[model samples]
Target: MLPPRWRLAATSVVVVGALGVAALGWWYADGRAAGPLDSVIDDRLISRGEGYEHLLWPLADLGSPPALVLGMVILVVAAVRTHRRPAIVLAALGPPLASLVTELALKPLVGRTHFGGLSLPSGHATSITAQVTVYLLAFAAVGLPRRALLRRALIVAAPLVVLGVSGAMVSLERHYATDTVAGAMVGASVVCALALALDAWNRARSARAARVPLSGQAGRG
Candidate 1:
C-alpha cells in the first residue's frame, strides 16, 4: 500500500488532471479545429521526418485494442500472483472503463470531430497512459527490493511511453495535440481515483474486523 502522504500526493495529481481534462474539453467543444496551441505543439512534438515512423508507429499501436488487452492481462496476472486485489482491479478494469468514458461521454458531448470521428480525448492515448500507470503500480506490488535506480527508472519511463504514444497520435493526425493531453489526464485521473477508493475500503474493512473480535471478547467477559 502507498503511504498516506504518497496517497495524498496522488490525490492532488488526480484533482489537477481532472481539472485539466475538463478545461480542455470545454475549450475544444463544438467540433472545434486545431487551436493555436495545437499547431504549435504539433510542430514541436512531432516534426520528425519519415524515419521516425518506424518507432512511432509501434509506440502508437501499443494503445490499440489488441495490444491493450494483452498488456492488461499480463499486468493483471502479475497483480493476482501478488494477491493484491486493488492492484488487480486497477489493472484489469481501469484502462478499458476510462477509455469508454472518454469515447462515449466526453467526445460526443464535446462534439469535437476529426476525420469524421469523435476526438476530444484520443482513445489510444487514454489506453496507453492508463496501462502504463497500472503496470507501474503492479511493479510496486510485486515486492521487489526497494532500489533507488529502479524507482528513478520507472519515473522516467512512464512519461516517456505516454509522450511517445501521444506524439505519434499527433504526427499521424489521429488526434489533435490537445486531445492527446486530455486523454492522458482522463486515464490518470480515473486510475488514481480508483486507488483512493480501494484504499479507503480496505482500511474501513480492517477497522470493522478489529471491532468484531473486540465485541466477541466483550460478550464472553
Candidate 2:
C-alpha cells in the first residue's frame, strides 16, 4: 500500500531536482564556465548536438496526430490490465500532456523560442518519460506478483531507456538541458503520485474491511 507522505516526498524531490538542473542549465546557457565537467557536457551535447538531431527528427516528424493516437492506444491497453489502470493512464499520458501543453500552447502564446525562450522544458523528453513510465508501471502491475526480482529489475531498467533517449535528444540540441530535466520531473512526478495514491486508497479500503464484522449482531440474544 502507498504511504501518502512518501508519495508527497517523492514528488517534492523531483521538483527540487528539476529546479536544480534548470539552474545549472541557466548558468551555462551562455556557456561561461570553464572546466573539465563543462567541457564534457558541451562535447557530448553542445558540440555534437546537431549531428544527433537526425535520430529524433524521424520521431518528431510523426507530429501530434500520430503520436497522440499511438499514445492513446498504449494507454488503453495498459489501463485494461489488472488493478493499475490509473497509474498506467497517468504514466502513459503525463509526459505527452506536459509536452503538448508546453510546446503547442504555452510556448507559442508566450512567444518563446527554443534558444532564449522559456523552452527550458522539453516536450520530447516528457513524451519519452511518459511512455517509459507507463511501460514500467504496467509491467509492475501485471508481472510483479509472478516474479518480484525480475519485475523490480525491469522497473529499474525502464527509466534508463527514457533517460537515455531523452538525454540523446538533449545532447543533440533538440531540447535545452532545462527542458529535458523538466520533462523528466513531469513524467516521474505524475507516475509516482498516481501509483502511491492508488495504493493508499486500496490500503484504506482494506483496513475498513478488516474493521467491519462479517455478520450483524444487533438482534443476537
Candidate 3:
C-alpha cells in the first residue's frame, strides 16, 4: 500500500484529471456535450434495462441523503470506539465541506445542465465519494490492520462503490457521465487533501514539541 502522502498525490492527480475532462466536455462539446466515450458508456449502461437497474438500486442508494447520514453515524461510532479524535474531527467535517464546495461553487461555476438543473458534478456522487473516502481514512487512522481482510475488501470496494453510483446516475438519466466523474474527483480530492493537511499538522506539532524539550535541556546544562 502507498504511504499517505503518495496516496494524497495520486488522488490529487485523479481530481485534476477528472475535473479537466468534465470541463472539456462542458465547454467544448456540442449538445449533451458528453463526448463519444462518455456517451457510449452511458448508452451501454442504460440499455441494460430493469434487471440492471434493480441490481444497481441498492448500491446507488448508498449515495442518498439518508444513506449519507447513516454513514456519518457509523463513522462517528467507529471513531469514538477507537478514540481517534483527529479521525473523528476529519470525518465530521470533511464530507460536509466537500459537499458545500461542490454544490455552492463548482456546480454553479460549471453551469452545465442535465435533467433540468445544473449537473456538472452530481451531488449524490459527491456525497458518496466523500463519505466513503473519509470513512476509509478514519478506519485507517483507527489502526485498521493493513493486512486485514476487511481492509483488503474495502480497497477493492471503494472504486466499485463510486462506479456503481456514477453508473446508476447515468443509467437513470439523473446526471451526465461527466457530472459523476467530476463529483468523484472533487470528493476524493477534498478528503485526501484534508488527510494530508492533518497529517502534516500533527507531524509539525510533534517535531516542535520534541525540539522544545531538547532546547530547554541544553539551556539548563
Candidate 4:
C-alpha cells in the first residue's frame, strides 16, 4: 500500500489539476453559450421544477451559516476528545481558508457573472465541500479504532453530500454545473494541501525527536 502522505500528495495533485482544468474551461468559454456538458445536466435537473425545490432546499441549506456552526462544533468536540492539536488547528483554519479562497480569489479571478454577481465557483458548493473536508480530516485525526465504522460512513457520505449540494445548486439555477464542479475541486484541494502540510510537520517532529537521544549521547561522550 502507498504511504498515507504519498496518497495525500497524489490526491492533492489530482484535485488541483481538476480545479485548474475547470478554471481554464470557464475562462476559455468566456461569453460563449453553455456547452452540452454544462447545459445537459443542468437542464435535466431543472426540468424537475419547483416540485423538487423543497427537497433540494434543505440539502443545499447544509452549507448555510447554521449548518457551518454545527459542523464546527462537531469538529471541535472530536478534536478535543482525541487531543489532536493538528486536527484542531486544521478545523479552525481550513474551512475559513477555503471560503476566503473561493470568495476573495477564485470567484473574483474567474469573474463569471450570475444574477448580477460573480459566481464561477459556487459559494454554497464551496461551503459544503470545505465543511465536509474539514470534518473528515478532523475525524480521521482522532484515530479511534472503534469509530472505524463512522469513518467509513463519513468517507462514503462526503462525496454524496457534495453531489447533492451541487445538483441542488444547478437545479435552482444558483450555479452552472461547471461552477459547482470547480468549487468541489477547489475545496478538496485546499483541505488536501493542509492535511499534507500537517503530515509533513508531524513526520519532521518525529525525526527530530528520534535524533535527540543520539545527539545527547554524543554530547555526553
Candidate 5:
C-alpha cells in the first residue's frame, strides 16, 4: 500500500493537472494565446496529438467487449477455484470499467472540442492511463509483495510513460493541451479513488472481524 504522504502527492498531482487543463482551455477560448508563438505551439501540439490518436485504436480494442468477456471468464475461473479473488477482480473489472465510463460518459459530458472528437479529456490518454493502472493493480494483487522494490518501480514508471506519450500527443496540437492533461488527471484520479476505497473497505472489514474475536474472548473470560 502507498503511504499516506505518497497518496497525498498523487492526489495533488492529479488536481494540479486537472486545473492546468481547465486553465488552458479557458485561455484558448478567451483568445489569450492567439499570438503567433502560441499558434506555433498549438500546431506542434496538434501534430503530436495525432500520434496519440493513432495509438488509441489498438489500446481501446484491448478493452473491447470480447476481450473483457474473455478476461472475465478467466478471472471467474481463477477466483472460484483457486481463491484468487483480488487478482480476478482487478484484471476483469479495473481497466475496462474505468475506460468505458471515461470514454462514454465523462468525455461526452465535458464536450471540450478537439481535432477529431469532442474532447475535454483525451480519450487516448485516458485509455493509456487505464491500461497502466489496471496492469499495476494486477501486478500488485499477485506479483509485487515478494519484490517490493521492483514492483514499486514498475508502478511508478508505467504511469509516467503513459503520461509522457499522452502529453506528447496533446502538446503537438492533436488535442488542446488541456484535453490530454485533463484526461491524465481524471484517469489517474478515478483509479486512485477506486483503489483507496477498496483498501478502506477491506481494512474496515478486517477491523470488525478482529473486534469480533476479541469480544468473544473477553466474554469467555
Candidate 6:
C-alpha cells in the first residue's frame, strides 16, 4: 500500500525545490554575475569526464528527442500495466509536457543561455528528470512489490540514469551545474504536481462512486 503521506511529502518537496530554483534563476537571470558561478561549475566539471566524452555523449542524449520518445514508450508500457485511468493518461502526457515547459516557459523566463540556446535549466536534465519522476510515482503506486522485478529494476536504474545524464550535461559544459539542478527541480515539480492533482481527482471519483451505492441503498431502505 502507498503511504498516506507519500504524495503530500513528495509534492511539498517539489514545491520547495521549484521555488529554490526559481530564486536561483532570478539571481542569474539575463546572465547576471557574468557567468562567474557557471565558470566555477565548469571548472569543477571539466576534468571529471576522464577522457570518456564519447561514451558520455550517448548517455547525455537520454534527454534528446529520441530518448524522450523512448521514455514515452516506457511510460506507455507502464500505463498498460497499471489500473488507474488517470494515471494511464498522466503517464502518457506528463513527462513531455514537463519538458516543454522547461524549454519553452522556464528557459525564456530565466533568460539564461549557453552557446545560442536558452539554458538556465538544462532541457536535457528536465526531460530525463520528468521521465524518472513518472517511473518513481508508478513504483510508489505499485507499492514496491517483491514480485515486480521490472519495476524494481526501474527503481534502481532511474537515479543512475539521472546521474549519468546530469553528469554528462555538466562534464560536456552543455549546462552549468545550476542549470542541471534547476532543470531537475522543474521536471520533478511538474510531474509531482500533476500526479497529486490527478490523485485527488481519482479519489474524488472513487468517493462519489461509493456514495452513489450508499445513496441507492438508503433509497431502498
lDDT of 4 by residue, 15-36 (tens): 7746674665466344334446
Each candidate's lDDT (Cα)?
A: 0.81, 0.56, 0.74, 0.73, 0.58, 0.80
Candidate 1 runs further than 4 Å off: 141-148
lDDT of 1 at 30: 78
TM-score for every candidate vs. truth? 0.92, 0.62, 0.85, 0.86, 0.64, 0.90
Q: Worst lDDT window (10 residues) for model 1?
A: 136-145
Candidate 5 local lDDT, 8-80, one digit each (tens): 6556755775576566545444332233544566676555557465664444444345654564565446445
Candidate 5: worst 10 consecutive residues by lDDT? 29-38
Output candidate 5 Cα RMSD.
5.4
Q: In candidate 6, how many Å is residue 144 off? A: 4.8
Model with the higher TM-score, candidate 3 or 5: 3
Give the distance in Å from residue 217's predicted Cα in candidate 4 to where it truly belongs: 1.4
Q: Where in model 3 is the C-alpha error above 4 Å?
A: 1-33, 141-147
As for TM-score, the candidate ahead, 2 or 6, is 6
lDDT of 6: 0.80
Most lDDT-accurate candidate: 1
Residue 216, candidate 5: alpha-carbon lDDT: 96
Clashing pairs in 4: none
Q: Per-residue CA lDDT of candidate 6, range 134-196, in tens?
A: 877755555643467766776788888888898898898788878888888888888888888
Model 3's lDDT to the true fold?
0.74
Model 6 residue runs over 4 Å out of place are: 32-37, 144-153
lDDT-wise, the better of 3 and 4 is 3
Against the true structure, whose TM-score is highest? 1
